[model samples]
Target: MGRMVPAKAAFAGLCSSLVGIGLARFAYTPLIPVLIGAAWFSPGQAAYLGAANLAGYLAGALLTQRIAARVPVRPVLRGMMLLVGVAFLACAIRLPFAWFFAWRFAAGFAGGVIMILAAPAVLASTPAALRGRVGGFIFTGVGLGVAASGTLVPLLLEAGIAATWCVLGALSLVLTALCWRSWPDAGVAPATRRAPPARSSLAARAVVLEYGLNAVGVVPHMVFLVDFVARGLGRGIEAGAGFWVLYGFAAIAGPMATGWVGDRAGFGTALRLGFVVQAAAVILPILTTGTLPLAVSCIVMGAFTPGIVPLVLGRLHEFAAGDPAQQRALWGAATASFALFQAAVAYGLSFLFAQTGGAYAPLFAVAAAALALALAVDVVARAIGARQVRTRRSVAA
Candidate 1:
């Protein structure tokens, strides 16, 4: 029973992570078009702000290694919650685009730190058997957050964009308070790195590639889907918002409901399945381009990518290398790579979307093709990684 207590605490921490990182932070993607319209920022300027946010995210992820070396995970996670709230409020106040960029940048860092930190605690604390399911529920917070933001922002926009900002900022604060109330207060792990050979081994590189492929496979859903539903479907803002709601809810369902299956079935297989589903879903928008197709595709996208995050993180435990401090630095680098891939795909699609006036079939087809490509690459990488791990074990024996 005493042993079960940390698991319970970790679950609470997971909730905090969802609110800070998943809900407050990730919701920005779906809100991207709307924010540009409201702030009168150029698409280029918006892109810059988005990049700035990713940069901060990179910094936070990198720093988690140092923080974890000194403190336990839960306290660090709790502190991040409050800081994330402040940063969200900073964005809500509508700073100059430059300052807003900085604040969003900071928010990204805090969010990355919070989510990354939560994983180690969950990993260390969760029973290996149950880890995947709990991971799914924890990850569900992202979809829930995305869905909440998607649904909340549009509803508030109906009242005015200012109202929308206030609502998001306020929700973050509430989450911060909830975090403080529920857990020990500390920042994330400290920064540290391991010295291996100057270059990474093939296995590390493979892990990075697999993560990057996952990012590419999901980019269209991240960047273009909202506009696709709005402009392509001839829906108003309400309908556009509803499309995100569907997407976010589906994302939540993917990780939350099916996470256990991934744990039992294996993340690699789960990932392949997710990629196939996403490929099929992206095709839906291409073929039908109707409200129903759009909604279904959103659900499919959510299932594939959302499950990928927790699964990858969970698998990190399999070949634990370096000090725990260095482990997070490794993971953060991988995350930065993931974010970089997403950014490139985002602006690329935006350019394409503009060229076509959101014709969408090309984009959806391209996205499906990307996911298939990723899925193929992952198959090769995972096979090699598995073989190498088995070889090392045989040598040790």
Candidate 2:
């Protein structure tokens, strides 16, 4: 029984993330065309509806820490999961544009709250040696949810759209029930008694900036990769969905692989390498439209999408010197930054897509540029941090 406690807590966190982000957000991607084809919403309206989720995500990220401060972590996590299931069910019926928008937003908000609170809640109680592995496992839920959507959403669509949403809602509820008793009784509030080191603060800020830019970098693939494959390349929805499946499969490997690497090579090294590889992947589509190239792009981008989260989380843990309170505060700030950039870039890309008569290439080009900038920022920040360390040692001598 004692041996299983940490595993159970990790499983609970995974369920929260799976429902919060995996199903709540990615499930809507493949459904974009269905919503349009069925005359449920115009293309423009459908695009904006996706953006609404990001907007709500931003709101949720900004508020999660504050909410947790006032409430216990376990119930907040469970309630957010319940809210997401409810949102999925609410989205089943084709109501007014406002109705769908609001539900998507609510679902997104729940996802943000879950994303902010879940893993940290588990990690606080995790043994130090296992933090990376457990953190990686917790985030696997996002990929599992993504993979399930890619394969399951299509099968569910056969029964019709409304039924599909209802099924997703049902699955979420079932997972929630299974994990209801698994959460650790840890509070998420950061301690106000001590400030983090000045150098750590600087490094954390640099990492946060990089993470926000990464959010911009991923928007192209996250929001439009399916549509690009489906319509831009003249492939049908099934083919586009095949790419999403490839993405999902790659995503499944991303977190675990990266976490293993972080546990050995250091999170900073893993993250820097990831930025380079993902930047290349993001740009591959613009350079070529060949079958091999697109597949490679999808796989690489998919792996890094959720993979990078664990690396960042692990890195923040390092920066905080394993202080849970400081780690929680830094992570909350990082999430809000990511949410802000993701929402802004999502809306900006949607507008650009419309303005350019649905051009997809330029959007990817812009994303690649954002990633390149992120890599440069990380390098400069690391250099400065290293210099500060050397100087401090010299003065002490």
Candidate 3:
């Protein structure tokens, strides 16, 4: 245990996640107007690309289970980074819509692998005493990535979208190389992970349901939040950039806050609170789009949403008995759920906005509804699990 804090694991995990998340997911929001203006994509195309990216992420998540089981996590993470670089470079070509979609999918797949892999690996490697702090710091890399992209993409948008993609790809590759070099090879444990729930259907359905509800709540923020500000709120690039910076910082803080809370209290409490925070965060900014309220919402969303899902992931370990491969699969599936929900929201709202002629408030209200539903589902699941634990205790007694 003392030897396990390999600098490589921490740096590689953080670097891989930053590039994967930044280049793949967070970049889309800022790139929206630029792509729309350049005539490279339509609203439909944008939504599809997001779905496709998540599909790719799902694939990567699946692939990671295999890769992590056979090979060391360090190399797998590095390879994903390089793959992301390729996908990023390919996006520079003013290819047909199909080609761009395919490239985006590949980026999503690679990025997903990095995100899914880095998250668990970071958490698993840390000593029990320091897990919360390290996890907080590792998760913050996502904010770092989001902040960088938000700030830099506008400058790139001033250039051509193609140039922007190329530079982003180049930057990711550089980071990947640096982190790969920094990473030390951690030992692999080849033993089969714990058997997943024997009641397969029940577990599967619960996970899917849990993930789906959470996804619906998040998509509005992830896909349309920035665009809402730019288009509906009438706040342009600076507002968009500033909003995301606030979000990124908040994301970095969220895991740390929750991690501490989890350490002090219980994981369930942290997760429930996180979902509540997410609902408020999305709703508050839409209700009041000024600097102050938006800033608060940004912090709220950033600190809460991104980290809560991982808390669910941790909970899965308790039920699944810490089976690494199965845990990875669950996370990959969750990411897909996240994307699909976002797509549904975007597509659904695109039509609604077209019809109703309302502001972002209505759409945000929809997101809030979704989060509320997710919280309900989570509360039910937590209650059931608690009951089961009590039953087993009673039987043993």
Provide TM-scores for the models: 0.83, 0.93, 0.84
Clashes of 1: 13
- Sort the predicted structures by TM-score, highest score first: 2, 3, 1
lDDT of 2 at 329: 74
Off by over 4 Å in 2: 1-5, 187-199, 355-357
lDDT computed for candidate 2:
0.85
Clashes of each: 13, 0, 5
Q: Per-residue lDDT for 122-165 in model 3, tens only?
A: 65655555555555556666767667667788788788888899
- The better candidate by lDDT, 2 or 3, is 2
**Candidate 1: segments with Cα more than 4 A from true spot:** 1-8, 29-47, 67-75, 158-163, 181-204, 290-292, 321-330, 355-358, 385-397
Candidate 3 weakest ten by summed lDDT = 186-195
